[model samples]
Target: MEKKVIGRRERITLPEWGLKMVTAKVDTGAYTSSIHCTYTEEREVDGVMTLFYRVLSPDNKKYKDKIIATSNYTQKKVKNSFGQAEVRYKVSTKVIMFEEEFDAEFTLTDRSKMRNAILIGRKMIQGKFLVDVAEVNLSLKSKK
Candidate 1:
């Protein structure tokens, strides 16, 4: 089946994560997309650090309905906007937008204070889109 294309900036829904109508910034400069999370806890389950946390939006609303995840490994020394490095947990999941699905990495961090909850980076959108900076929500608005 052919995949539906998306733009640089679009509103997406994470049905499995119970996140609806969240805006994401499509950044080609970044390799992985990061999501805003809080109350992160790492517990050993079957010799693996099972991650559980709550994702928060800029409005301080918690997506408490969907607050569970597990990953194979955790990456240390990840660089932040200030060029300083910090450890972060990477979780793999399927992101659905515009009727298209793709495997994407979601790095957990507290971005509740930031403007956006998700950053749809290049890795998730590689070969799947053509970003037009002047445009926003092309997929959502087109349906209307």
Candidate 2:
């Protein structure tokens, strides 16, 4: 299989959450992908424990103020930038990049201080893409 080339940074979409053109940084050093979440909570919905979370802040006019709820989530111990172990919520969502759709798992975390809201890790790009550090937005450019 020929792997597509992606840049160090690319635009992606989460169709299930109504998000488009979200900037995501490629981090080959990390194992699991992560997304910035405003907040996350566990509540009983329709008699089932559900995980609800919101992504991006209201300032991001294009996609904001939306809550995504699902029982299909898990918690895992992930290392932070400081290399400290922290348990974070992980969920699967449909990610669209370079016009290709695929299911990818993203860990929910408070990345308000980070430059980009999304971080695409090795796991998500492993078998599908090759990263070019000097390039950026290769996915979006491919459409032009």
Candidate 3:
């Protein structure tokens, strides 16, 4: 397999969830990737616990204010940027990388104050991409 090279920041899409051109920051320090989420609601749908949440804030230009649902998900304790451990929802989804699709696990958290809407951690980048410190948006460039 050919190694795909990406930059420090890349634009990724979650096509299955109707999201496009979502900005994601590549972080080698993080163990797992995460998506900015808010207004999370949990309800029993047909006797099964389901979660509904929105990705990114509505004020963001690419924001859709979409209410995404997931039946197969988990709540795990993860350390935040402040080094404080908190429980967050983990969901599996397909992410578009180098214009190819791959399965990725994302933890949902309220990143309203963060610069990027999504974060691609070390697990997602391992052996799949080479990072160039001087570059950004390599995925968007490849799409053209």
Candidate 4:
């Protein structure tokens, strides 16, 4: 069987997070993908540290549906667009693109200030997609 190739900007459904249709910006420049989250909390379970967070969609409504994920690792001094360095937490999850699912790492951050909540970076798109800057959602149409 041949693997299906995904496009730059695609509509994705995060069922675990209760996100029906989310528009993600496929950025090859970013090493790790990121999602907009709010009310993030770090907790310990049986001596293992775990993270729980809520993803905020572009609609300005908080997806109270919490996702419990384990910390893959921590990154330090990540430079942002404004040249500001900040530390962020990284987590792993399965993302479905073009009806295909794959495990990918995502950095958790409050991206409410940004335009889109989810950003699909190069790490997640490698060998799976090709970006067309002029086109958006060329793969799947958003149900929202």
The per-model lDDT (C-alpha) reads: 0.74, 0.92, 0.87, 0.71
Per-residue lDDT tens digits for candidate 4, residues 1-144, read 454455556787766556666888887888788888775678887888777666674355455555556655555456665678788777777777777777887787888788777888888877777676777776564323
TM-score of each: 0.83, 0.95, 0.92, 0.80
- Rank by lDDT, descending? 2, 3, 1, 4
lDDT of 2 by residue, 13-113 (tens): 99999988888999999999999898899998889989999988757876576889999999999999889999999999999998899999999998888
Tens-place lDDT per residue, model 3, 6-125, is 998998889877788777998888988999887788999999999998877877655556788989899989999999999999998998877789989899998888998799998888
Model 4 weakest 10-residue run by lDDT = 57-66
Runs off by more than 4 Å, candidate 1: 1-5, 58-62, 71-73
Better of 1 and 3 by lDDT: 3
Task: Count clashing residue pairs per candidate.
Answer: 0, 0, 0, 0
**Cα displacement (Å) at residue 76, model 4:** 5.0
The best candidate by TM-score is 2
Q: Is candidate 2 or candidate 4 better by TM-score?
A: 2
Task: Arrange candidates, best TM-score first.
Answer: 2, 3, 1, 4
In candidate 2 the C-alpha lDDT for residue 57 amounts to 70
lDDT of 2 at 45: 84
TM-score of 1: 0.83
- lDDT score, candidate 2, position 2: 87
